[model samples]
Target chain A: MAELSEDRIAAYAASRLPGARDVAVSGLARISGGASRETYRLRLRYVDADGRSVERPLILRRDPPASLIETERHIEFAAYRAFHGSPVPVPQMLWLEEDPAHLDYPFFVAEELTGFESSPGALTGEAYDPVREKLGRRKWTILGEISRADPEALGLTTVMAKVAPEDCWRRELDYWEGVLDEDEVTPQPIIRAAIRWLRANPPPPAQKISVVHGDFRTGNFLYDAAGEIHGILDWEMAHLGDPLEDLGWGLNRIWCWGQNDLRGGLLPRDQAIAVWEQASGLKADPAALHWWELFNCVKGQGIWVSGAKAWSDGETRDPILIISAWRMFNPQDRAALELMGRL
Target chain B: MKPDPDAVLGYLAGLMVQTIAPQVQPQYLAGVIGMSGMLLGMAAQEWDRAADRLVKENRAIRGLFRQAERVGLDADLAQEVRALAGGQDDDLRISALESVNTGLRAALISLHAAVETRTDAASRALNDAIWAELSASTSRRAYTGSPF
Candidate 1:
């Protein structure tokens, strides 16, 4: 529990609701296993203007003292708004409070879509065995729908800085490589070598400056036994950039959590791409996809190293950070090596 | 040797995390204590075999570096290889062995890269050796919870 107690949350809710009374919050328990944000599930009960009692389940995602990836809450809120009620399902975001007075740090509240498993290992279990293909189709198809969305029309361009098609690769590469340079505790010769190679062979200008769901992959979505994806979560890294960037990220080998060539612990890599291509009506140019694939390895390594640095520096004290850093570092390096054709 | 130090450390770590940390206050301290538990767990896994793994890997890297020198290589890289190959872990401390290992690995990467660009059969064979050493090095460092 944070300094802001359940009473404070209820008080805040009462103020937001014009005719509500006796606004109370209960069942305020923190959900385990989020390194970037502290997630809590609570129930909000209040008497409405009609004198009817209403209850709603809500989730609070508060910014941690330090995070694995620094991201904007507003961008995630805007991304939710952009996808809600569309083919790409997302929880409806209610409030984004940037004021530290409310909570020591920025936070956002959204509808809690319960009754679904989101773990990467869950998808590989026997319970989901029958619906694997269906889930796979929905996963990539929703990504295709995201790729199909217009950033300008969705008002994302105003929030996500627009990048030139050719500059997209450079901007993303530079940013992630910068993270690696800043956070690396040890020499990463493999990643350093890959960075050099990426610079030597930059991808072609993006086919379209589509919205890139920066961390779009397995374990980032809510799914059930019926092969339905309820909500796309973790849009904190959402931005407008090369669409192929998302495709490449999805195709990264690390997301092959099932330990197969298939991506996202779901469908085969080519099949997943096929679904995306068919839905978005875009060709995944081989050379461009290859560059982005290798670039993602660099990006992944950057994220893992940053996790290690965050733990080492004592900026954040979360077990997930330690778990992430130790588990992902060497694998990320190996992925980079494989991408650079060294393995 | 009867009750392995590694097993005892791991048991103590489990006790600290599962039995003790939760009872503490100031959530931040609990997290620190939890991480200390993890460090202990990792240390327990590493403690007993650290010297053995380092010794084996140092010997392996030295042999590879010597093989690299036998190949007709660029003079500067060959000298670098010769210098690394001639070195030994004089100080038996884990930190000292680690320092020497880091130096050898860095040299290995350079040698591997050098041989990667060459067309000679000896360069190719040396490249294979370097890759094997790199693979072995990762395996040696791999922990129980590693994703790979």
Candidate 2:
């Protein structure tokens, strides 16, 4: 594994850009907080085919040796490319390399939406107080747009495995349950019980098999001072599943970062639902939505426990795994309990 | 032991989060260091209560197993619950206590699932008790910085 030097990245970019010269990858320092990938913000400078100098900010996401979740980089790149110019604000994906030889691991590069905030802690401050409601409205409205998309038209059907609307719940539930069974270092009695309940009573067929942004919580997107979401990032877990699944994830109580009653710490739960319904032109059936929300809690636990297992086994010594397990697991259980009416 | 373990951890965590993290470049590493600091802070909090919480929850789950025996359940499940109820956490080490807790809670899941199928007063009472314990367990392990 070669060191991730600027010279190496510059050479790789030069190779990718035909007829381009003086390609330099600079300021290639990693930005923190991505548990699944090593994310970095870099500057790409080059002379284009027209002999004009060009410079742009870009993001590099490379697969880690082990992570909280497993996902396909090509599918993520395809997802961003497909939704690039759509109502959804996804950064334009520029290059994808699967051959780990280039950077010692598979990675993809996309245009960075610079100067936008993605931290939930930042959104809850006095600076954002005035526009929190506006941000919430746009946040879920964008998700609604994603739910309303046609997977086949977006070329996602080919990349993301197709699933019958009726089988969506079973597929997601089984996969996450399998994750829990394999990765849990300790017995998860609460999540296990929730899984049993989810199996006994399943949600109805998905209204549509839209792209579920496997993680659409508050911190995953880029926002601004005026409460605008510039880019919907982190499509690693994106797949074709229930539209309500995305909605349910956004509405999960664990995301209430403001420590208030607001869903996503932005809007009331009903208000968020109404905004989504109006935007997607789809009804959020109460029972089915409830089922997905609880299922997401199970999924959330699976992810947290997997991180714990990865750390416990010395697969990765990253402290983020420990932080995630300590902060997330208990809340995930409580969220499931709340959905089950046992809280 | 002169300086309390928890106090030492707190000082180390503060250094990482407040002092070292801010001095680092590449904003992401700083954030990671900051999170490491927060995790250590929470760990310092957990250090004092780990064994006590595990033992108390283990005893509480064992008590539920005994109650599950009274609530109508299948022969195998009843036998499992009775066997769990008969056991005790003789080892107070956190690792031993947690290992025992896992087994007891796994059996409790089976017992709870069995009790859910029955409609008698005893089953309903046991169901209520199970929910209460699960809720209590979460609260017991609740970190001060819990997202909820």
Whose TM-score is greatest here? Answer: 2
Candidate 1 residue B93 C-alpha distance from true site, Å: 3.8
Q: Give me candidate 1's interface root-mean-square deviation.
A: 4.3
The candidate maximizing DockQ is 2
Tens digit per residue, CA lDDT, model 1, A1-343: 3685788888878878899899999988777535678887889999999999999999999898888998898888898888888888999988888987776888888999988888887787788879998999999999999999889988889988889998999999999989987997666667766777789789899888898999889889999889999988999889989999999998887787735666887898789989999999888998999999989988888887888899899998677787677667777776666766655
lDDT of 2 by residue, B18-90 (tens): 8999998778778888988998899898888999999889889888988876776778888888888888878
Give lDDT tens digits, candidate 2, residues A282-327. 8999999999999999999999999999999998988889988988
Q: Rate the local accuracy (lDDT) of all candidates.
A: 0.83, 0.89
Fnat of every candidate, listed in order: 0.12, 0.74
Model 2 misplaced stretches (Cα beyond 4 Å): none
Model 1 docking category: acceptable
List TM-scores for all candidates, in order: 0.86, 0.97
Q: Score the docking of each candidate (DockQ).
A: 0.24, 0.74
- Each model's iRMS: 4.3, 1.3
